[model samples]
Target: MIGYLVLALLGLFVVAFYAGHRRAVASVEGDVARLHSRPSQHGLYLALLSCVPALLLLVLWSLVTPAIEASIVRARFAAEVAEMSLPQVQAFIRDARAIAFGGIAGFPDETKEAAAALFGTLHGWSVRIAVVLSLALAAAGYLYGIARIAPAFRARHMVERTVRGFLILCSVVAILTTIGIVLSLIFESLRFFQQVPIYKFLFGTHWSPQSAFTGAGAEEGAVNTDIFGAVPLFAGTLLITVIAMLVAAPVGLMSAIYLSDYASRRVRAVAKPMLEILAGIPTVVYGFFAALTVAPFFRRSGEALGLDVASESALAAGVVMGIMIIPFVSSLSDDVINAVPQSLRDGSAGLGATKSETIRKVVLPAALPGIVSALLLAVSRAIGETMIVVMAAGLAANLTINPVEAVTTVTVQIVTLLVGDQEFDSAKTLAAFALGLVLFCATLALNIIALRVVKKYREQYE
Candidate 1:
């Protein structure tokens, strides 16, 4: 019914737009210059008036009708509802709605049949009233808007004002969403810190939350907070990120320089897109490749060299993660390099500098800030990656930096901690939120540093 109502509102909007447009043209005797707004603006004004109010009405009616039906049905079946617990009563209402709307219902009885019948009747009347009232409101809005349209009507002003208000609303939503996330993280981490001290979580060496309880059948809040140390996870994250940067930074930057400065136009066009396709591939696919292919190859090579390597090691995951974020660095660095002014290159050439010298001395210095920003963003991407680490790097929170050692990252630990059915109030579960808070702070700091570098160097070049 709501879908049909929406389609009806759409048709009314089309009719209202045409009517308003023709009426405006007739009022001006087809002389567009005599009107304060364009004919399209008048049409849009009428369309918004005819459709927006009806859409809002439909949304409001849809939201409230189910609750209204439930309330009235519960009142009609008070005796039946009074015998059931809250969950059972809620289930009974769900079953009644399902039967009324044509679905299999659990625990159907005579009382439920009567309730379903009553709900169906009420729902029918509610939908009908909603449709009639919505159409009436849309018709009234069409009339009011059409009546107001004239040679001197400020339709464009009103439309622009409405659009500006919508943009402001979107901005406010984004800001509020960020604040909500930060507050949730802070609140949850504080709960975790209440059980585990902040000093232990930040500076302790062990990272075993599974053994948090001292013994069997321990009471709540009796956790061995010393095992909640995060140093190993922090070390593993830094190790993988460093390895990924070693792979990504130089390769990505060199490719970007080649594409921006040295490659022919045809080669650039083909190669850049092909390189960026890596970014579009799912991270899960890269995880599978790392786990199934790269890890084994590394193990075999280590064996041939008479060295022991873990089957699941940081090297495989870090290398694959680097390959994944290559596009982030290459695409951004290419754009930054290309954005260096052509005049700088031209002046360098006039001074008898070769292309290499010009790129090294002039273009690189100009684009240095943007390149650094791109690299820092890639580092953040590397830090946040969970799939590759989970697949290729085993979930052992070892404090070793050896590339061939099996280690876990903060994101991977967060996933491990939250995977099963567990008590949210326990330090084990709440530890995920603390890890998340730490990860958030790290990435936020990287972004802030990137912005600072961009600002500091941008002035010298500009």
Candidate 2:
């Protein structure tokens, strides 16, 4: 609530700043020395100065407050719980926190009262301090800008630079988040490798994570600990991705071509968005469609052909996933194909080439980079997709190449490993992180290769 108030205050300040600057500029005109910027630029300069610094501080405060409060709470309890074992103390702290935050109840009366008092005081003070500090900074900046609104202020250029920097910071934050996730996955995978050999995980033929917790004395040196082969999951993921690409690529590309090259303007206007409507459908809907409808149809069809087929078949899941990816491929490819210079098409036509020949040899080749990028993007989506596979693809990790067989992908395994009740410290659960690391690396490699391919294709046109 305080954050919203701060934003509201900042917005009001901007409006005031703009109004004041415009009034000042209109009144002064050419009577005084030349103004450093236009009236609007001067307003923007004041507005940015009033908001940016305070917003930055508010963001920093928000991020650090939780850690600080947690530390304080831990310190308060440390002496009281010192006699307890580390694990027990930790558990107690967790329970106390839950009670304090209204997540759970049934704490000791004294502990609950103390926790409530502490949390209320800290939270109230934190919010008050944040609001006070931000308001003060904004007021100061606003006043300074107002005072400097004389003809000498270089407001426009400074505001532009500040806005550019702000945008850059936002982009950097997104990139940094991706980097952090990849690093976390790498670290957890390293921990997993400590328990199971990397070679066994990568190359072994059998993959039964449930076996890691088997037997009466499985905690001791288990015989089957080294059987964590990822071949089947990898193969299944690849097969599904390939099948999806096969379904998406030709259909999406041809759709793009028709929209860009052949469709009448009115037809294109109606059909483009209609086709893109496929993208809006949720994956969960697709999941049920695959599981309830597609899988049964496949099974019945296979039975008719006198062939053995699993009710939850890979073909069913892969085909559904492919359909899900069609919009991504078509939309991206369409934009890229349209972006190709019309001069190239015109030049081709002047050389006695037919429209189909011009498109085939000229437009498609030129737009190949974007098409490859779109396909790679779709491949990444297929690899990471969870819900459809979880529902349609069976959980059995069969190490086979047959598309008709029941197969599981990495995401399915990850979902199963982490779902329901599970210990986070167990090998079974930790294997999900290991799988995530592999998936991340695989997708990153695909994107890089795709980017390179696109760049090379662009160079040919250049």
TM-score, per-candidate, Cα-based: 0.90, 0.88
**For model 2, what is the error of residue 16's alpha carbon versus the real structure, in angstroms, after optimal superposition?**
3.6
Residue pairs in clash, model 2: none
Candidate 1 residue-wise lDDT, 299-360, digit = tens: 99999999899999999999999999999999989988987889999999999999999999
lDDT of 2 by residue, 1-462 (tens): 675867677686668567657755865774534676777778877787787788888889989997787678768766767788978666665666666667775555676557656866787798989888988988898887777776767777887899899899999999999889988898888888887888889887788888885744465645355557898899999888888888999999999999999999999999999999989999999999999999999999999999888988789999999999999999999998988999999999999999999999999888888898999988998999988888888899998878888899999999888889887767777899999999988998988988897788677665
For candidate 1, what is the lDDT? 0.93
Q: Which candidate is the best by TM-score?
A: 1
CA-RMSD of model 1: 2.8
Worst 10 residues of 2 by lDDT: 215-224
In model 2, where do residues sit more than 4 Å from their true spots?
1-4, 26-33, 67-79, 85-101, 106-108, 215-223, 339-353, 357-370, 420-424
Candidate with the greatest lDDT versus the true structure: 1
Each model's lDDT = 0.93, 0.84
Q: Lowest summed-lDDT stretch of 10 residues in model 1?
A: 214-223
Measured on C-alpha atoms, candidate 2 has an lDDT of: 0.84
